[model samples]
Target chain A: EADIYQTPRYLVIGTGKKITLECSQTMGHDKMYWYQQDPGMELHLIHYSYGVNSTEKGDLSSESTVSRIRTEHFPLTLESARPSHTSQYLCASSEKTGIPSEAFFGQGTRLTVV
Target chain B: DQQVKQNSPSLSVQEGRISILNCDYTNSMFDYFLWYKKYPAEGPTFLISISSIKDKNEDGRFTVFLNKSAKHLSLHIVPSQPGDSAVYFCAANFQGGSEKLVFGKGTKLTVNP
Candidate 1:
């Protein structure tokens, strides 16, 4: 089983509230990614990190920011939450060796900005 | 323009029957393809993968066939069980300096027991 974990399986917050979704993995993976998706919809990449101190925005535009100070942790933060931000956030990791290109995913965080 | 696309929104199959899910991609740079399974409110789980060098890959009870010429791929599951019901997503990775996975819209598979 993949050792990735995401906190607050479900969260409900008011608009303008700042919140952070925590993600961590026990495996020593060099690549990490964050994706946003609505129920039953396709996943849109929001942010990703190549390694510590390396972060980049993904295909989909997001009003969120992420930091990679530690290889095991990649957290996504919303400075000012909005109703439009309500969706599922998924965190994933992959080894840089590229042997197994498949990514291991966390259980995911379901956020509701009311 | 979406790089990856799963045209089927949902698929249904009876128990012990074969279930096939299809995906298409436009980017030739994507040499690595993967299939992921996800449950409601849960994250996607890696199911299987294939490289561009090969046209087919198989894991117990699951097989993925790739057609580079057509830019299409299909995942087949034999003896489908109710437990196999979940959302299936297709993703592609470009073998480059910054390797990342590009995902499709996803197809929900319902295995009726």
Candidate 2:
């Protein structure tokens, strides 16, 4: 089974508050990614990490930042969250083998800024 | 332009029937394709995947078909069940999983018992 996990399955906070979404995986994956999804929309990649201390912005622009201090942990932080940031945040990880491999995803954090 | 596209937003099928979901991609660089199933309030789960070298890959009730020339792929579910009601997202891996995955908008499948 996929061992990736995300904390705070659901969250509601006032605007201007800062928040951090936690993601971790026990599968020892070298690649981790953060994606944002809105209802009826596609999952958009916001941030990704190749390995420890290797972070890159994804195809979509995001206000949140991510840190990969350990291979098993990757966390996303949003500074001064706004109502526009209210959406579902998904974390995923996959093996870095050159061959094809499917990614494992976390339960996701549904963030709402009121 | 969206690299991957799922033209249909949703589809409804009856139990014990077949459900077909289609996807198309604009980038030929994508060498691996996958199908993901998601439910409400949960993250997506890997369903099945197909490599560019093969045209079809089957796993029990799920089968994924890839057409490299047309840049189209599809997922078929045999004997659909109510439990199969969920959103299906088509994803493509650039350069055979060496790069990030590109996802389509997703197609919601509703299977009535």
Candidate 3:
């Protein structure tokens, strides 16, 4: 089983509130990613990190920011939450090696900005 | 334009029957494809994957067939079980280029027991 974990399985906060969603993985993976998904929509990549101090924006433009200071931890933060930010955030990781492999995902964090 | 597309919004199959889910991609540069299973309020789990070099890949009860010429792929599950009911997402990326994986809208599979 994958060792990835995401905190705050469900969160509901008022508008303009700042919040941080924590994600960590016990597995030593070089690549980490954050994806956002809405109901009946595809999972869109928002942020990704190749390694520590190497973060890149994903295909989808997001108002959130992420930091990869540790190999095992990647956190996503929203400075000012809005109702539009309500969605499920998923964290995933994969090893960087000879061949591309499948990524293991955490349970995910559901954020609701009321 | 969406790079990947899962035209079917949902699929239903009876128990012990075969269930097939299809996916199409617009980007020819994508050489790697993957299928992920997800439950409600949970993250997607890696189910199976296929490389462009090969046309077919099978693992246990699941099989993935890729057609490069048609830019289409399919996932087939035999003897479908109720536990297999979940949302399946098709993802693709350039294996030799970028690490970003593009995903489709996903197809919810319902296995009736």
Candidate 4:
């Protein structure tokens, strides 16, 4: 029932392959974030966008890049996938109007690079 | 350094029992706390939240207590059921900024029937 959506719920690809993970929300939220979580590990903010034409790298240093061309879409891309890139990528969106931006997440995309 | 920590990795409770999950934060700037529950293979869902102004916030069987002085918070689930079994995460954020949530590692709770 979550409005946010991530494509390729599960993906297994060879190393050196380029891939793009698509995330879209219908809620028209101005804030979008991409978090990376490994099994039994804390979630790490990889990238975020305040609004269209505004994007920044998060606390965690990641080789991935993200772009937000429209309010409803935020796509993360890896120019070259590696074994270290295997992890669960979660997409979330929140409204900026509140004091605390409580996020709504989409079912994560589990990626495995072999 | 981990600003937020959930010391216990896992907890087990019997059905209909009260389940208590603990969280601690080191950042004084965090003024709001939130709890999220996640099932396997799914994203975390917002369970409950508390503002800096209140010590306690309740939603049905779930209650969150924030002790700002101790930099700690706890989530209580009374009469816990099997369906309540999930990984719970504690998150915190401040007001002056963009309000990005800093999440703890999470504690996995198992409710035995």
Clashes of 1: 0
Per-residue error for B81 in candidate 3, Å, reads 0.7
Residue A54 lDDT (model 2)? 97
**Which runs of model 3 end up more than 4 angstroms from their true locations?**
none
Q: Write the per-residue lDDT of candidate 4 for residues A74-100, one digit (tens) a residue.
A: 999999999999999999998988688
DockQ for all models: 0.68, 0.81, 0.78, 0.79
| Model 1 stretches with alpha carbons more than 4 Å out | A98-100
Model 3 Cα lDDT, one tens digit per residue, A1-114: 999999999999999999999999999999999999999999999999999998999989999999999999999999999999999999999998746678899999999999
Candidate 3: residue A21 lDDT (0-100) = 98
lDDT of 2 by residue, A12-111 (tens): 9999999999999999999999999999999999999989999999999999999999999999999899999999999999998877688899999999
lDDT of each: 0.93, 0.95, 0.95, 0.94
Task: Compose the digit string of candidate 2's lDDT tens values, residues B1-113.
Answer: 89999999999999999999999999988998999999999999999999899999999999999999999999999989999999999999777444788899999999998
Candidate 1 residue lDDT tens string, A4-90: 999989999999999999999999999999999997678988999989999999989999999999999999999999999999999
Query: B4-102, model 3: which lDDT tens digit per residue?
Result: 999999999999999999999999999999999999998999999999999999999999999999999999999899999999999998867666788
Provide the DockQ value for model 1: 0.68
Which is superior by lDDT, 2 or 4?
A: 2
